[model samples]
Target: MINKNVFNKTKVSLIKINVAVVVSFFIIFSIFIYSYFKGLTYNSVDRNLNDELENITVQLTSSAIFSPIVLKDPSNMVYIYEGDRVKYYTRNGYFEDMLPKFRENKKNSFFTYTENGYTFRELSLEIGKYKIQIIRNIDAQINSFKQLIYVFVIGIIIAIIITYFIALYLTKKALIPIETAWNNQAKFVQDASHELRTPISIVSSKLESMLRSPNSTISDEVELIADAMKETRRIKKMINDLLCLTKEDSITTLNKEEVNIEQLINEISNDYLDIAEVQNKKFNINLNAENKIIITDKNKLRQLILIFIDNAFKYTNKNDIICINLTEEGRDIIISIEDSGIGIKDDEISNIFDRFFRSENVRSKDIDGSGIGLSIAKMLSTSLDIDISVKSKLNEFTKFNLIIHNK
Candidate 1:
C-alpha cells in the first residue's frame, strides 16, 4: 500500500512546479504585451502631433494668414514664436494659460509637459525664422493605459487560479500509474520473502537434525541430507525465477526473427513425449495451420508454451491425456495446450496469471509449483503480442489457448 502522506507530498510538488512555470511564462508575456500596446498608443499620439506641426508650418510659410480651421480641435494648442516674440497663437480651452516657454535650442524635439494636474505631449520645431510649439492633451490615453495595466493584473490572477486547478487534475492523473507500480512492487517483495523463507527454514531444520546426530555415518543420515539438498535446489530454482522476472521487467525491446511455428511445436512436443511416456500419460500434437512461419521472439514463445505444457502435466495423473493443438482462424494462429487434470475453479481463473497466486485446490493438494510460471508466461505473451485465454472445469479438464497474430 502507498503511504497517503508521501503521495500527497509528491502531488503537491508536481503542482507547485507546474504552476510556477506557468506563472513565470505569463508574467514575461504580460510585460511584453503591455510594453508593445503602450508604445503603439503613445506613437499614434506623437504621429498626430508631427502631422499637425507640418500642416501649420506649411500654411505660415506659403500664406500670410494662419488657418483657424487647423486649430479648431480644442485638445491642441499651438504657438508660433519669432525671435522670442509671439508671431502667432491659438489658445486651447482650459489650457490657454498653461503654454510652454519657447526655447531657441529645442528644435525638432518631442517632450511631455505637466501643469495644473494636466499632461500634454509637446513638439517644438524651427520653421525658417519662426519656432513652432504644438501641445496635445494626453490625459485620456494615460487613463486608458492604466486600465490596460489593471486588466493584465486581473487576467494573470485569473490565469493562475485556473492553472492551479488544471495542474492539480493532471498531477493526480499522472500519479496513478506510479502508485499502482509501487503497490505491485511492494507486494512482489513481500511474496518473494515469504516464498524464500519457507524453503530456507526447511533446509535449516533438516541440517540441524543431521547435526544433532554427529556420530551417525553418511549412509545412516542420507534421508535428512537428501531432504536438505532438495530444499536447497528448490530455493535455487525460485531465485532463478525471480531473477528471470527482474530481467524481463528491464527488457524494453525484443529480438524478433522468422520462426517456423510447426517445427518449434514439434520440437517441444518431442521433448514432452518422453516425459509423458515416463509418467504413463498420453501426449499428442495436432498442427493444422497452413502457414507456420511467424515473426516473433522465438525463445520467448518457446518458454511460454513450455509453461502451459508443464502445468498440464503437473496437475494430471497417470494415463491422463495432454494435447497441443495448432490451428488458424483468419490472420491469427492459435496454439492450445489442454489436459485432463484437476482443473482450476471458475472464480480462480482470473487470478491464475497473478504472481505468487495458487488456487485453493493446488494448495490443498500440495502440488509442486513456485506459482511464478504463469506470471512469466503472461509477461512473455504480452511482449509477443499474443493473447492467452483459458477454459477449465474443476476436477475435469484445463485448456490454455494462445492466439498469435500473424504480422
Candidate 2:
C-alpha cells in the first residue's frame, strides 16, 4: 500500500544504490578488458616486427656483396653497404636523410619515424658485408587501434544503458516493503483525521447551539453542557495521545532512576483495584520475582504499564479477571498483563500496533477509543530500546509481554 510520495522517494533511493553498484562493476570490468586487448595487440605487433627483421637479415646474408644485388624493388625495402662505402640505396635519398640520425644512436633497435608526413616503423641491422634496413608502414594498424578505442567507448555506453535498466528493475523489486509502509502511513493519517473530526464537530456544534440559546440556564441545558464536556475530554485525551506519538524527545527527556519493580507494580495495582471493584471485575497480581529492581525511566514505564492495564480494563466484561504477572529470567525482567477480554484476530494482530488502527470487533461494539494507545506504546518501546509483544486469541484472552533488560 505505497502512496505515490513514499514510492517515489523509495524508488529514488533504491535506484541510486543500484546505479552505484552497477556502474562501479562495469567500470572495473571495462578497464580490465580494455587493458587486456591493448596488451594483446601490442605483443602481436612486437612479434611481427621481430620476425620481419629476422627475415631481412637472412636475405642480406644470402646475397653476398660480390653478387649484383637489386634492393628496393616492388616489395622489398633494403639498404646495402660495405664498410664506409654505400653499395646500394633503397630509393634516391631514403638512406642518406635518416641514416646519419640512426648512426648517432648506439642502440640497434626497432623504432617509429616520420618522413614527409608519413609514419613508418624501421629496424636497422648489420650483416657481414652489408647493413640492411627494413621499413614497414604502420599507419593502417595505428588506425585499427584507434578504431578499437572507439569500439570500447561505444561498448561502455551501451553497457551503461543496459545496466541502468537492470538497476531500475531491481530497485523497484526491492522497495516493495517501503511502498507498503508508506501506504499504511497514509491510511493512518486519514484515519486519525477522521477520528479527530468527529469529536471536534460535536464540540463545535454543541457550543454553537448553547450560544444560540442564551436564555437557557445551567439547569435548563445540563445535558447539553454535560455532553459538550464529555466531547471536550475525549478531544483532550486524543490530543495527548497524538502528542505522545509525535514527541521525538520523549525518551531523551525522561527522568530515569533505579525503580523498585515490586513496589511500582504494587502501587499501580492498588490504584486500579478500586476502579476494578467499581466495574465489578477482579484485579489480580502475581509477583513471581521478589524485590526486583530495574534502572529505567520510571514515568515512561508507568505510562506503558497503565496503557496495557487500561486497554485490558476497557475491553474486559464484568466478572472477568485481569491479571498482572512479574517474573525475572536470566538478566531480564519480564512483565505480562493478561486479561479475559475480547481478544484480537490473528490477521489484525500484526496491525494492532499501527497508529489509529482498531479491530472491527472493537468498532462494532462502539467502544470509545482514539486507537492511538498501542501506537504510542510501540514508539516508546523503540525509543527506550525495549521489546514488546502481544499474543491473543479471538474472543478468548489477550496478553501483552514487555521485556525489560537489566542495565
Candidate 3:
C-alpha cells in the first residue's frame, strides 16, 4: 500500500544516511593521518632545536669565560649570563622583556615562549661558569600546521558535496522498481472501482423503479426484474473473474500429466463448433505435429484455450475464419490461435492483456464482456511457465502464440 511519493522519499533518506556515514569515516581517517604526521614533524623540529642548544653549550664551555662567544646567524638568538648579570646576548633589544623573565624562572631546562606574534623554543644550559640560553623561531612550522588544517576542512566540504550528488543518482536508480509498482497498484485500484461502479448503479436503479411501482402486476414488472437479475449476474461474473486473476498463481498446484495435445484441441474445437455455427463463422482446427503428447496442467490448459476461443467468437464478424493450430518447432510446442475477426489495431494489440482493457472498436460495440478474461489467461500462462505473444494488423487479423517447452 505504499504510495509513490512516500516510497521515493524513503529511498532518498536512506541514501543520505549512507552517504553521511561514509563521508564522516573518510574525513575522520584523513584527520587522523594528518595529525599523526604533523605531530612527528613538530617532534623532529623540537629535537633539532634541543640538539643545536647542546652544541652551543659545548662551544661556550670549551672557551674562556670572557672570550666573547659571538654568533652572527640571524636565526639563532643566544643569551650568555654570568651569575645574576648578563655578560653577552644576541637580539637583546628584541627579546629584552621575554629573556629577563625566562632567565629568572629558569626552572625547566627547555621551554617555549611567544613574543610579538612569533613562537620561540628556548633551551637553557649551565656551561662551565656560564649559563647559556638558546632560542629558535618556529613561526613557520606553526603556520604550516594551520595551513594543513585548512586544507583538511576544504577537502571534507568537497567530499560531502560529491557524495550528496552520487547518493542522489544511486537512489534514483534503486527506486525505479518501487516507483513502478506503486503507480501500477494505484492504477489497478482505480480501474477496479470504475469497472464495478456501472453494474452496481444499474442494478440499484432497476430495483428502485420496481419499488416505486408497487401496485404494478408481476407481468408489468417482469422486464425490470429480468434486467436487475442480468446485471446482478454480470456483477457476479466480474467478481469471479477478478478472483481468478488474483489467484492465478494457484495454477502451479494443478495436477499435471501427459495430455494428448491433438485430442485436447479437438475437444475444445468441438465445444466451440455450435457457438461458431450460431454466428455463421468458420472455426477451424489444424494439428500439424505427429507427436501430440505434452506434459502440462490439463485444467489450466483448457482454461487458456477457452479464453482464446471465446475472444475469437466475440471479436470476429459473421462468416469470418478462426483457426486453432498446434505444431512442433524443435524442442517446443506452439499453440497458435488466429482470427480473421475485426482485428485489433496495431497500437491496441500490445495492451490487450492489461486488466479491464478493451479496444475502442470492442467498446463501441454492444458486446457483453467484463474485459478481464485475457488478463486472467496471461496471468495463468505466466504461472504455468508458458510464453504468450501476439501479432496483429489493424482490420486484417490478430494472432496469439503460446509456446510451451516440451520436455
Candidate 4:
C-alpha cells in the first residue's frame, strides 16, 4: 500500500497542474470571445451613425429644402449651427440646452457623450457654412455588452469547477498502477526475508552445538557439522534463486535462436537419467514431435525444463516413475512432465506458481525446497511465450504440460 501522505501529495500536485492549465486556456479563450463580440456591437452603431451623416450631407448640398420632419429614423436628432449660434434644430422647444455647444474646429469626427443618464454616439460634419451634428441613443446596446461580460465570467467559473473534479478523477486513475507495483515490491521483500530466516537459524544453532562440544574430537561432531553444511548449501541455493528472479525481472530483451527441440530434450533426459539411476528411480522419455526446430531463448528454455524435472526428482521416492513426453498438436508443441509421486491437492494447484508458496502436503513431508523454483519457471515461460497447465491428485500423480506455439 502507498503511504497516505505521499499519495495525497502526489494527487494534489497532479490536480493542481491540470486545473492550472485548464484555467489559463479558459481565461484566454473568454477574453478573445468577449473582445470579438464587443467590437461587433460597437461597429454596428458607428456604421449607422456614418450612414446618417452621409444622408444629411447629401441633402444639404442638393439645393433641396431641408426639413427635420423628413428624417426616417425618429431616434436620431440633428443640430445645425452657424458661428456659435443654433441656426436650425431638429427638435422643438428649448432642447438646445440638452445638446453640446457646437465648435467649428471639430470636423468629420465621432465621439460618445452622456448627459442626464442618457448615452449617445455623436457624429460632427462641416457642410458649407453650417456645422452639423448627428446623435443617436445607444443605452440598449451598452446594456447588452454588459450582459455579455457577465455571461463570460459565469461561464469561466462553471468550467473551472467542472475541471477540478475531472482532474481529481484522472489523477487517481493514473496512480493506480504505481500504487500496485509499490505494494507488490513491499510484499516480495517481506516474503524473501521470511524464507531466509529458517536456514540461517538452523546453521546458527548447529554452530552453537559444536561450540559447546569444544573438547570433543571432530569425529564426534561429524553429524552436527554435516547438518550445518547442508543448511548452508540450502541458504546459498535460496540466495541464487532470489538473484535469478531479480535478474529476470529487470531483463527486457531475449537472446533468441533456432533450437532443435528434440535434441534439447534428449540432452536434459540424459543428464536426469544418471540422477534417476543413482537415486533408484525410473525415468522415461517419449519424443513424438516431427517439427523439432523452434526459435526461442535456448538457455531459458533449458532452465525451465530443468526446474520441472528437478521438482519431480525431489518429490518422489525410490521406484517412482518420472516421464517426459513431447508431441505435436496442430502447429503447437506440447511437452508433458509426469511423476507418480507425492502429488498436490486440487485446491493448491492454482497457487503453485506463487513465490515461496508451499503446499501443506509438501510441508508435512519436510521436502527440501525453497518453493521459488516454480515461480522462476513461470517467469521463464512467460518470457518464452509458453503456456503451462497442471493436473494433479493428492498422493497419486502430478503432471505439467507446456504448450509452445510453433509461430
Candidate 5:
C-alpha cells in the first residue's frame, strides 16, 4: 500500500522528469543547429579571405620591381613584391592582424597564424628583391564567428521554450483519453458492486432460515448450498471493498447530531458480553464517562463498532481476553478495542484491512470470515470523519483505536 503523500509526490516527480527530458532534448537540438550554422559561417568567411588575398597577390607579382622588393600598403592589403623582405598591410593598417598566416618554412605558398581565437593565413611571392606577404585578418573573422554563435544560442533557447510548450500540449492531448477511461472504469466497478450487495444479502438471509428449520435434514446437498452461499457473500464483499477503493467521495448528506458515545459503547459491549461466555472467552468494558455525546451518525457509527467486535471474535482462539475501553481525549471520544488472541503479525498488519486478505495464521486456525469486515469499518469511519488506528503484535495482542471529534 502506498501512502497518500508519497503517491502525490511520486506523481509530481514523474511530471518533473518528463518535463526535464523534453526541455533537455529541445536545448540539445538547438545547440546542434547553432553549431552547424556557426561552422558554415566560419568556412564561408575563410574562403572569402583566401580568395581576396590570392587575387591581390597575383596582381602585385605580375608587375616587375627592383631587387624583388615588396611595397606594403599598410592601408588596402595590396602588396608589390620585389624580393625576400615581407611587410604586412591591410585596408585599415590597424587591421593587419586580421589576415591569416602564410608561413615561409614549408615553402608551401601559404602559411597560417593563430592568435586570440583568430587564424591569420599569409602568402608571399617575389617579382624583384622585395617579397611582399599578404596577410588575412583571421582574428576578426573568428570574432565574427563567435558573435554569430552567441546570437544563435540566444535564439535557440527562445525556440526551445516554445517547443517545450508544444510538446506539453501534444502530451496532454494524447493522455486525455486515458484519464477518461480510468474514470469510467471506476464508475463501472462501483455500480456493479452496489448492485451485487442487495442480492447477496437476501440470499444469505434465506440460507440462514433454511438451515435452521426443524424439518431440515443435514445432507451433502445442503452443505454444498451453504458453501456456495458463503462464497457468494465473500465475492459480494470484495466487490463492495473494491468500490470503496476508488476515489469517489460519497455524496454524504451527512446529518450531524448530538449523540452519547459512552452509552453507545456500553450498550455494544454489553450485547457482546454474553457471546464471550458461550464461546469460552472473556470480555471487559471500561467506560470513563457517563454521557459522552457528540455530533455523529448513530447508525453508521454503531455499524463500525459492530464490525470491529465481529472481527475480534472471528480471529480469536477460545479462552482469549477481549477488552473495550471508552474515554475522552481532548474534546474527542476515543473508543478502543483490544483483543488477546493470535494477534496479527507485523508483516500482515498493514494488509489486514485489505479486502479478501485473510492471513495465513487465521487460515491455519480455521477461522471463518469474508475478510471485508475491517474494510467496511474503515470506509464508514472515514465517512464519519473518525480516525482509526491499529496496534497489533503477533501472539501478544491486537487493538483498534477509534477517535471521534466532539464537534
Candidate 6:
C-alpha cells in the first residue's frame, strides 16, 4: 500500500506532471517575451523624446533677432524668456525657460508638469545671454510601460491555462509504451506462474510418496532412489519459489456481502486448530474487534486468512505457536499473523512478498518455501482492496498485517 503523504496512482499520472511543467514553462516564457517587446517600445519612445528636444534646439539657435519668440506647434509649445532684459514670450507651454535661480538648468535638466503629463529633459543654452530651453514630455512612455505590464501579466495567466490541456495531450502520447510494457510484464509473470505450478506440485508429491515407501521393488535401489528424490524435491522447491514470484491479481471482482469479521476469523481459527493438531503444531487467535460486520468477498478474504495460517504451520517447527489477531487500527480492520518459528531476517522482510523471493538466510537453512504464499496473499488482498504489509526480526517473530478499508 502507498503512503498518504505522497501522491500515488495505480496507473501512471503523467498527464498531471506534464500539465504542470508546460504551464510553468509557458508562464515564464510569456513573461520573457512581454519584457522583450516592452523594452523595445520604451527605447523607441526615449529616442523620439530626444529627437523632439534636438529639433527645438535647432529652430531656436537659427533665429537672427535677439528678441524673445514663441513657437506654437501641435506636438510642442515653446516659450522664450528674454533674459537680462526681463522679456517673456509664451506659446502652447511645450517649452519653458528656467528662472535665474535655475540658471544652471540652461544646459540640461529634467522636470515634470501635471498639465502636459511628463518628467522630461530640458536642453538649454546661452544664446547672446538669452537662455533658450527645449523640453518634451516622457509621460506617454511612462503610461505605455504601465499599461503594457498590466496586459503582459493578464496574457501570461491566460496562456498558462491554455498550455495545461495541450501538455496533458502530449504526455498521454509519450506514455503509451510504458503502459503497454507494464501490463505485458504483469501478464507474463502471472501466466508463467500458472503454467509452472502443476509440474512442481506433481514432482514434490511423487517425491514425498516415494520417500514414505520404505519397501520397494529392488532393495539396492534405495540409496539411488533416495538421491533422485532429494534432487527432485530441491527442483520442486525452486519452481515453487518461481511461481510465488510470478503471482498477480487474477481474481477479477468479488460478490461482496456483509460477513461477521469475528465469525470468519473464528472459522479460520477452527480450521487452523485442526490442521495444527494433526501436524503436531500449535496456533492461536486474538480477536480484538468489538464489531464484526464487514462487507467483502468472503471466499477470497477467507483464502487470504487460510494461507497465512497454513504458511505459519508449514514453516514453523513442531509445537511452535502461530498467532492471529483481528482488531481495529483507526478506520482500517487490522488482521495480523505472527509466527514463532523461522522469522525472516530484517533486510529480507521487504522482499518477502515479491514473487519467488526467499531470504538468502532462509535458503541457506534449506527450509522448503515456494515463496508464493505471501505473493498470493498480496494479490488477493489487492483484489479485495485491502492493504497488506509485513515485519519480521530474525529468530524473534514474523508478522503480516492485512489492513482492510472501512468502505
lDDT: which is higher, 2 or 4?
4
lDDT of each: 0.87, 0.78, 0.81, 0.86, 0.67, 0.66
Q: Candidate 3: misplaced stretches above 4 Å? A: 1-26, 46-116, 120-137, 164-180, 215-222, 243-281, 290-303, 317-319, 380-385, 394-396
lDDT (Cα, tens digit) per residue for candidate 2, span 135-201: 6666676777678778777777887788778878887877766667667777867887899999889
lDDT of candidate 1 at residue 201, scale 0 to 100: 96
Better of 1 and 6 by TM-score: 1
Q: Count the backbone clashes (under 3 Å) in each candidate.
A: 0, 1, 0, 0, 41, 3
**Model 5 residue 373 lDDT?**
68
Task: List the candidates' TM-scores in order.
Answer: 0.90, 0.70, 0.71, 0.84, 0.49, 0.46
Tens-digit lDDT track for model 1 on 231-284? 899889889889888897543268899999999999988988889999999999
lDDT of 5 by residue, 141-160 (tens): 56766786777677666765
Residue 162 shift from truth in candidate 1, angstroms: 0.9
Per-residue lDDT of candidate 3, residues 1-407 (tens digit): 55557866787797879688978897888889788977787677657756666666666668786686655455777777778788877754455474645454764466777877678777776766677777778788778878888888888888888888888888888887877777777777888888889889989999899999989998999998898889899899999898886674575567789999889989888888989889899988889987788898998998998898888888889889999999889989999999998788878877888888988888788677878999888877876788998988777888999898888
Per-residue C-alpha lDDT of model 4 across residues 108-172, encoded as one tens digit per residue: 87777676677778788887788888878788877887898888789888988999899989999
Q: Flag clash pairs in model 4.
A: none
Candidate 3 global CA lDDT score: 0.81
- Candidate numbers, best lDDT first, in rank order: 1, 4, 3, 2, 5, 6
Better of 3 and 6 by TM-score: 3
Clashes of 2: 1
Question: What residue pairs are clashing in model 1?
Answer: none
State how far residue 41 of model 1 sits from its true place (Å): 1.3
Q: Report how far off residue 46 is in candidate 4 (Å).
A: 2.9
Task: Flag the better candidate by lDDT, 2 or 5.
Answer: 2
The alpha-carbon deviation from the true structure for residue 304 of candidate 3, after best TM-score superposition, in angstroms, is 3.7
After superposition, candidate 4 runs with Cα above 4 Å error? 63-83, 86-97, 100-136, 214-220, 248-250
